[model samples]
Target: MISVKNVTLRRGVKVVLDQASVTFAPGEKVGLVGRNGAGKSSFFALLNGSIHEDSGEFSIPPQWRMAQVAQDMPETTQSATEFVVEGDTVLQAARAEVAAAEASDDGMAMAHAYTALYDAGEHDAPARAQALILGLGFSVAELDQPVNSFSGGWRMRLQLARALMCPSDLLLLDEPTNHLDLDALVWLEAWLKRYAGTMIVISHDREFLDAVTQVTVHVDNARLVRYGGNYSKFEDMRAEQMALQTAALAKQADKIAHLQKFIDRFKAKASKARQAQSRVKALERMEKIAPVLADAEFSFEFKEPQNVPNPMLSMLGASFGYPAPEDAVAGTPPTVIVKGINRSVLAGQRIGILGANGQGKSTLVKTVAHALTPIAGEISEGKGLNIGYFAQQELDVLDPEASPLLHMQRLAHDLPAHLRAGQGTGEQTLRTYLGTFNFGGDMVKQAVGTMSGGEKARLVLAMIVWQRPNLLLLDEPTNHLDLATREALGVALNEFEGTVMLVSHDRALLRSVCDEFWLVSKGGVEPFEGDLDDYQQFLLDEARSQREAAAASQRKR
Candidate 1:
């Protein structure tokens, strides 16, 4: 068992944990949650012995073998499989001993070392490493690719795979789902379920914590509070506790009234027959989560669009993908990702894009956002179509060196005079607008490059809401946001009177904001027949099939 008894941990002058006490059993899967900057990472640092408690006691079994994903970006020429296989310290040590023994001409020592290596599962190490890489979204063709050849996010995935490769008594994962797509996240959940070691994870993703963890540890006001259930149960307990406070009572009343109004209006207004059933389900879902959102410290809403356009866009046999390089030969063809897409995006429709990793969900969204033009067929955008797009890589469209104020100023300058009527181009006016999105005073002038990922994501959202777009194309917008901010976004999207198309691994967000799903798979786009649960099952089956295929290939070798 691991115990932190009245621990006082600090970083500089910041009191991260003050007399906090918490305990974990030998095989507990714990979800560590708190607001951003609430010392979740610091607490993790303590566990891994990267830092120590300034006062009181913190200890774990000395013999426990620990594994954690390295935060550093990997810069290596080693093949992906080989790199991951090396994560097993025991196996590596045993093999090294055997080599050393043989070099010294010690026959008995060599025999013992070889037996130790065998006991450490050296027989199937390659297959185990390959499985981990594949389960984390790597393709078969990329197994032998050098680690440094991949992008930053892909390299991070490799790091996660390597950590999972290690045989340990304890596993610590921090924001493990940030780089994963929906399909990959599903696979990871299953893998963690099968992990025998005691696990502690720090994640902003609500559904992820709920699915994989049986207990939740909340860092609140410099103390670690233990809860016996998952994240939802913790919220429920929080709601009950907060009910006793007068201020919280007033807030809850206001939110309840607000949700009641929405529910009443939603039932009365049925613009589309197909969406009626989904709306009913969404109302029930809202009622369940409203109290939780009401408990959040911050909130914002999307501005009403200037004009609403029905059937915001229509794609007729559209093929979306990357075009051939500019310097390519004349006859070189483009690489089509999602092809033969026939779909219509209407006003006020909430769509969740579903697909396995690398299956073109982002490609289709990019095409709609006009970031990438369709390689073939036609995209008929409605008259006066205005889109607010949030890329999966939010940094892609942002000027990292520019301040939040400067970004808004540039946006104001880019807008036509007619669109700039109410939103002023003046510095003070832009600053005030930025303030509405929580960018205040010094933060307004702070360079985005130095800001945290969550802040940058918030800046992107603020810019999107400022546009007053009729259609929102959000791709993994919640990747960097904390739980409270995510709840805020869910409420904001629910209140927005516009079309929404989102691609995210955060199931909670998907359930809250989206009523319909579009599947981008097998190089085509089609309406998904079922809900997120069904899609998760599909992903699981696919993962199992992949594992079997990979094992079979390994056997042949």
Candidate 2:
């Protein structure tokens, strides 16, 4: 069992965990949740011995081995399989002993070393590592590829695989789904369920937490509050706790009233069928959890566009990718990921983009959003089209040194007055606009480089909506957002009277906001007739195929 007893922890001048106590029995699957910057990561650090408590006790069984995903980008020339297999330090050490025994030509020593290697499951390590890699969406052929050849997100998946390869008594995962697609997310949930180790995962994904965790430990008010059952059950219990307090009940009533007004306003509009349904669900959920998050500081909505346009955008056999460099050799075509996309997006249409990682979802979105020009075919936009694009990589669109107010100011200055929706492009208006997104007062002035990932994400969202764009092209906008913020984003997207094309792994947000689905795969984009559950099954089948192919190749070799 792991125990944290009246532990007080701090970083710099701020208190993170204050006299917090929590206990985890062996084989317990726990979910650790909190708002951004709530010391969730810090607590994980403490558990892993990367840091120490300022007061009291934090301890796990000394004999227990621990495993966690590495955050640093791996800079290695090692093959992906080799890298993951090395995660089992015991296996690595046993193999080293075998090598030493062989070199010395010591028969007795070699026998002992071989026994140790077998005990560590050294012979089956490759197969186990391959399963983890495949489950995380790696192709069979890519296992022997150099680790450094993969992109940042893929490398993170590799890191996750490495952690899973380790035979540990305790497993700690922080936002493991952030880099995964729906298919991989489903596979991981299943894998974690079968894990015999005590597990604690920190994730903003509600469905994921509900699926993998049997218990939830909420970090709030500078304390650790443990709740029984999964995330949904924790929510119910938390709501009940908050409702019992007279002060919280009053606040909850006010929030419910605010949400009810929005639901009533849009309930009768046929064009807003999806949005209305989503809003209704949000309202119902808010009633249960509103008091629990009475102190939540983040909220915002996309502004209404000045002019509504039908058939907002259309792509005719369009191909999306970067143009080849000027100095490129002949026969090297532009590097296209998505091609031959023929689709029409109407005003108020909410489309969710679905694909496996590296399947060109981002490329398609970037092309449609006009962040990248199509390499072939045509993309036509409605007259006076205004687009707000959120890149998957926040740093790509945000200046690290700039403040939120500054980003808003620059955007207002760059766009024409008409695009600002008649809201004058002035500092005070921008300041007020920032406030709506929870960037109030000094927070508005804080440098973007110094803020948390969630803070930066909110600022980017604020900047995007400030222009009152008629179309929103969001690529994983909820990546850095917490549960409350993700819910708020879903509500805002539902309320917006603009076209939205979203690419995200967040199932809850996608299901709530999207009326239609587009699958980007096989080097092309096409309308998907089914829903998110169908997509999950599709991923499982794909993973099974890869595993079979891997086994066949091993036999051939």
Candidate 3:
């Protein structure tokens, strides 16, 4: 078991954690939850010895091994496989010693090295490494790829894979699913459920936390509160606590009012004077219970345009793909991923694009946004049509050195001549736009680079709203947003009067916002008329049919 007692942590003058105490038993899976800056990461840092608390006692078993998957990666020039192997530094050193001993002919040195390596479990190192790498979704070919060649998301996965490879009695994971796709996330959920050791995971994904954790540890009001069962249970418990507090406050208020009336009526009489004085003292000494502040509830309202024309956009016989390097001419026929695809977007159409990763979802969005040229197709636009494109990595477009307000200013200045006239040109306009997206005065002045991923996503969304486009193209807009933000975006889309085309993996968001579905399969696209739930059922039935067909093929073979 691991235990913490009387822990107090402060950053400069502000206390992040005060007298927080918690315990984790063997085989316990706990989910840590709080608001964005509620010291979730700092708490993990304290446990990993990366930071020290003002006052605390943390105890763990003497023989216990610990591993942590951090948000940031260490700078290193190593391959992915080499990086995971290096996680067990002691074992690696032992193997190195064994190698050196075998090279030497001296019997005495060889015997000592063999004994040390055996004690460190050097004989089984290769098997352990292979199991861990495979479990974390790394193929043998991918294991040899250099870490520097991977993107930020892949680097995070590498860090998690390395942490899992190490033998540990206690595991600390912070937002492990931030970079994982659906398949990898499902695998991780199963792995953690079957793990024998204790785990503390900090995540904002409700479904993920519900699947893997058995308990919840909530940090609120600079204190720690433990709840039995998963996130859903904790939410119910919190609601009950609030209800009880409300009732107790009401009863106390009634008693206080009765005492006040008695004092007002009997204070003038000498016989009742003593009793009235006592009542006054009791009132003064009573501790008033403050009502709990409500959690922020987001309700988004999109600014609807007055009138939008039909046939907002259309593509005729469109073909999209990258240029073939084998062709000598630059303008030669491009290799087509999709061809003879004719589609139209009418006003008030909420279309969702679905396919496996790398099957050109992003590419299709780019083609619609005019970022990519259609090799053999004609794209037609209706009159008075305005378009807003929200790229999956739209937050990365912000200038690191610029403040949010300054970024807004740059966008305003770049508007077309027809749209730039008669608009207010002050910081107040920018501040109002920022406030609409939940970024207040001081936060609007902060550098965009300093904001968290969720904050950056909000900033991108705020900028998009400023354009007030009639048609919105969102490519995985829920990627970095939390549950509240995702829901907020969904509400906005639902209220939007214009056409919307989105690509998202969040079932809840898609179900709430979209009214139609588009399935992008092998070299073709199909339109289906139904809500998200119907589409999901169709997908499952199709998958079942394919599985049965594969089984039949195998029998014939």
- Which of the numbered candidates is closest to the native, going by highest TM-score? 1
Per lDDT, what order, best first?
Answer: 1, 2, 3
| lDDT score of residue 188 within candidate 2 | 94
After TM-score superposition, what is the CA distance of residue 238 in candidate 1 from its true location, in Å? 0.9
Q: 363, model 2: CA deviation in Å?
A: 1.4
Ranking by TM-score: 1, 2, 3
Candidate 3 lDDT score at position 408: 87
TM-score of predicted structure 2? 0.93
What digit string (tens of lDDT, one per residue) describes model 2 on residues 25-98? Answer: 99999999988888999999999999999999888899999999999999999999999999988899999999
Which parts of model 2 are misplaced by more than 4 Å?
A: 103-105, 263-287, 293-295
lDDT per residue for candidate 3 within 1-557, as digits (tens), equals 77889889987788989999988898899999877677888888887878887998877788878988756765677877678777775676777887888888768878888888788766555445545554444554565678888777777888887788777888999888777644355556767888788899988676678888999998877777899999766866775675577666575555445434433433332133322233233223211211111233333455665458799988898887766677467657676776778999999777778764455777788888988788788889988787889997788888877888998898898977545455565789778877878888798889888988888888888777777778999987877786557645754675577889988766545554555678776877777555444554554454445434544543564
Native-referenced Cα lDDT, model 1: 0.88
In candidate 2, what residue range of length 10 has the lowest lDDT sum? Answer: 270-279
Please give, for residues 1-557, the per-residue lDDT of candidate 1 as tens digits.
Answer: 99999999989999999999999999999999999999999999999999999999988999999999999999999999899999999999999999999999998998999999999999999999999888888888898999999999999999999999999999999999999988789999999999998999999998899899999999999999999999888877776677667686685788767766766676566334343455566566566656666767777889988888888999998889999999999999999998887889998888988998889988988888999988999999888799999997777668988999999888988977756668767889888888877789899999899998888988999988888899999988998899989978887887889999999998888876677888888999888877778888999898888888889988998
Clashing pairs for model 2 are: none
Question: Model 1: residues >4 Å from true position, as ranges?
Answer: 263-286, 289-291
Clashing pairs in 1: none
Q: Count the backbone clashes (under 3 Å) in each candidate.
A: 0, 0, 0
